[model samples]
Target: MSTPAPEDCGYPSPRPRLSVEELPAAENTQPIRSLEDLAAGTFESDQELEEFLAFTCAERRRDVA
Candidate 1:
């Protein structure tokens, strides 16, 4: 399936930019063990969402300075 544009993601603005540091702090990250956890009304906050997106988008990109 094709990935939807950021605008289609339902943000107030289209293609919003997010800072890497703006992602949720690792200490506060929650464990997503199962789909049931998501269906149970968890996964709060946009920061967590951004973190997950970043992980998916940059997973193969090495951390180069």
Candidate 2:
């Protein structure tokens, strides 16, 4: 018997950019453990969505830098 190719199984055949060793992790950074972290919230309008996106982007930029 023969095994199917990655494309046949719905996976990309090319090698990914990063190996497991290259993954980002440290004592300060950890996976999300709380259910509330994945909670679904909504914005009432486009302006509100833009504001939320801008705020979150700035916060993440500061965090990663």
* CA error at residue 12 for candidate 1, angstroms: 49
lDDT of 1 by residue, 1-65 (tens): 99877668986554445566655453466668888777854458888888888897787575552
lDDT of 2 at 53: 96
lDDT of 1: 0.68
Clashing pairs in 1: none
Candidate 1 TM-score over all chains jointly: 0.27
lDDT of 2 by residue, 1-65 (tens): 99999899999898657655555543345568899877667877889999999999999999998
Q: Which 10 consecutive residues of model 2 have the lowest summed lDDT?
A: 19-28
Q: What TM-score do all the candidates reach, one by one?
A: 0.27, 0.36
lDDT of 2: 0.80
Off by over 4 Å in 2: 1-41
Q: Stretches of candidate 1 above 4 Å error? A: 1-42, 60-65
